[model samples]
Target: MVDLQVQYQQLKGEIDRALAAVLDTSHYILGPQGQAFEAEAAAYLGVKHAVAVASGTDALHLALRAAGLGPGDEVITSPFTFIATAEAIAYVGATPVFVDIDPQTFNIDPELARKAITARTRAILPVHLFGQPADLAPLQAMCDEHGLLLIEDCAQSFGATYAGRQTGSWGALGCFSFFPSKNLGCYGDGGMVVTGDDRLAEQLRMLRNHGSKVRYHHDIIGYNSRLDEMQAAILNVKLRHIDRFNQLRRQNAHYYSERLADAGVVPPREDGKGVHVYHQYTLLTDRREAVQQALTTAGCASAIYYPIPLHRQNVFAAAFGGVSLPVSESVAARCLSLPIFPELNQEQMDRVVAAVRGA
Candidate 1:
């Protein structure tokens, strides 16, 4: 649903030079490229620290580990997100409490999350789905009241903001993914964890490596989840153009919303609390299958972000089979994401809109 090749062609000169520099130095892992990217990303996100990791999943995993989450802990999160969100909590021997989402924003409903809280609840992990920032104000207050951690799953919201602050900077720790299709992705798998706390930052740095502050002395068991230098170099080049890229995506999304206003579909909604980066310009329609078929016939790409909620997935069915989250289930049945990217031209967007309208 993205045009990575076109974007590469547009930035070929800068990306090629960045890669060449890394190759010249032959520093493939935990080198200058990664260090520099972390610093640049931190500054851009307005966070005190950024720790690079192998994948977005690792970022979440390491963040949870650094936060001292373990067995018997419960992490409340939206069920309408990617499997990785819940998987990260499971990796740390914690239970992921499935919660419903807001109909418009498609983020975890703050009230529903608060209702799910229990004595075992250790954190609230909210996903900023489709580059739209969640309602962090209430969630943050709830965390503070409950003495819980607020970790953001910002895999789809690299440049999105909430209430004039960046998404990753809102919570205690923010996790981002650099998957190729993401808003600010790298050449391959890469991720980052950002935090304002000095202690959490240090713990994250150790957790991503072999849990070593020094060269050979390992403090705690850690994973080999370092972001490679090659990927970091690519991200560094892309980072320089992130604001422009996000702006273009936002413009395209607005265009789609305006064009699809009367197409019997629900266009993505921006709550005005923050800027939406439109990683995926998703719409909700009762005729999802027909619309998808029409797009395929017209040679246009469309996808379902999540066809089934995490609570309904096979892995968690036994544990949450009786639990009912009507909103998440209803949205999953109708959500259809159209092609969205900074490089998408007018013709492409027009073609997509025409297909949906014709359907």
Candidate 2:
């Protein structure tokens, strides 16, 4: 379905040298490599500060904590994302307010979000699900009108832009993940929290540490979520090629779209402001189970972004008061993520389309 080995071999020497440099430095935790990566990432996102963290999940937690989310606070967000989005909110003892998704973009529905806000709502965490940026304008306005924070869960759309700005920069705090399979994946687990407010940025830096900017002097309760220097080194190498890699993924997506035209599937959303990085060229179809079976039989692979909506999950069932989100439930049942990556060749893409068409 996809391949990362080609990239490893293509940049083997650089990676080897980078890894060796990490071993030589002996300053493994939040070392120079991590600092260098932070600057690079901040520049890439056009933000003032980028705090590297342990993983994408940690990025969310740090962002929430920095924004002052805690027990009794409510964060309105869609239920159609990876569990991490809700988990981050719950980590701080906050309630994850459930909302439905926009039928077209598979992102949080702004109208639903507007309806869900209340006095308890302290933040609105809109996810850029499946590489598509959520509509931010209205959501931002809602936050402004109600004095709520905006956090973007950009785990999939690391390089995606919205309305002339990076996806992560649109909100108060933009969180990212560099898991092994993301569009800008590292060698292992890594994450970052990007923000423009200098005060919030400073808080994130301190929070990732033990709530203290200086050593051995804790200011408040915090967690150890620092990014690994070695992983940062590896990501630095990959960051240099992410734009080119995204370009290839875009090209492959076009090929897949053209081939799947007759397969009775609604393609991923591609609109004016943002570019779908093909994080997963997902399609909407009722024949999800049959499609998966056929793709597997045809020597291909596929997946579902989520099989259950967050509101229905056991952890949140008792928190969200049995929220009814029809759109989220429907999308979860029908959506299928196809094999997509920069290295996916035309032949493989053709096989994927044919498998879906045949199914």
Candidate 3:
């Protein structure tokens, strides 16, 4: 799904220097490097605060915490996403109301989400799946009308923009992951929560650090989820080149879309509202098994984002046994991600397309 080694090699000098700096300081926790990255990230996203955390899961968990979600509350979201999106809700003792996704965008359907809301619904957590922003305006309006919060899972959309604004700036709180495969990844695990609300920002900071504004003085129950300084330093270096990287990804996406159309593979459709950063360049194919086998035989790699919907997962079977999300299930069966790293060459892309067509 990604070529992190090639990406790293492109920035070896900067990355090495950043790592050396972190080692010199010997401050690996919430040190100056992490603090600086937070500020830069906030500014880039047009948010007032960006709280760095240990992982994207932590960012989602803490964002829900900052939004005042708790036991028995429900967070309506798409069932066709990474487990972390729903897992964070479960971690906070909140029920995840799985809704069917829009088959075209592969994002939570606003109509379905609005229909799923109940008196227990406290928030709407929407994942910007495949680096395209969900239909956020309608979802945001829904949240506003129902007095619910809006949190964006932007783990795959670091530099993506929606309706002239960056994705993280649209929702009340936006969570991002710095996993090595993401658009703007660090060396290891790291994540961030961006928000414009001062109150929410302060709450997030406290919640990420044992609920203490001052060291060791616990005010509320919280988790130890601070971002590593070394990761932060590396992210800072990579952040400087994200625009160029994403531009290359966009170019590759356009090329693939054109070629894949000829191969009978349905390429991802741009919703036309935001910049689609082409995070994974996923395709929907009914012949997944055949296509995957063909690609493997040709020494090309392909992946399925989610082979099973959240509602069908064994862990949540008791709560969602009767739930029927046909679209989510359909998408889970058909969705296949191909090689979309920014560094992939034209020859590599051509080979992948040829393999899929051959299958």
Model number with the top lDDT: 1
Query: What overall lDDT, based on C-alpha atoms, would model 1 receive against the true structure?
Result: 0.94
The best candidate by TM-score is: 1
lDDT of each: 0.94, 0.88, 0.92
Q: After superposition, how far is residue 144 of candidate 2 from its true place, in Å?
A: 1.4
In candidate 1, how many Å is residue 54 off? 0.6
Q: What tens-digit string does per-residue lDDT give for candidate 1 at 1-359?
A: 88899999999999999999999999899999999999999999999999999999999999999999999999999999999999999998999999899999999999999999999999999999999999999999999999999999999999898988999998999999999999889988999999999999999888888999898999989889999999999999999999999999999999899999999999999998999999889899999999999999999999999999999999998899999999999999999999888888899889999999999
lDDT of 3 by residue, 62-151 (tens): 999888899989999889889999999998899999989998999999999999989999999999998999999999999999999999
Candidate 3 stretches with Cα past 4 Å from truth are: none
Count backbone clashes in candidate 2: 0
Candidate 2 lDDT tens digits, 292-358? 9999999998988889888888877676656778988888889898888887777888888889999
Error of model 2, residue 240, in angstroms: 0.7
Worst 10 residues of 3 by lDDT: 1-10
- What TM-score number comes out for model 2? 0.97
* TM-score, candidate number 1: 0.99
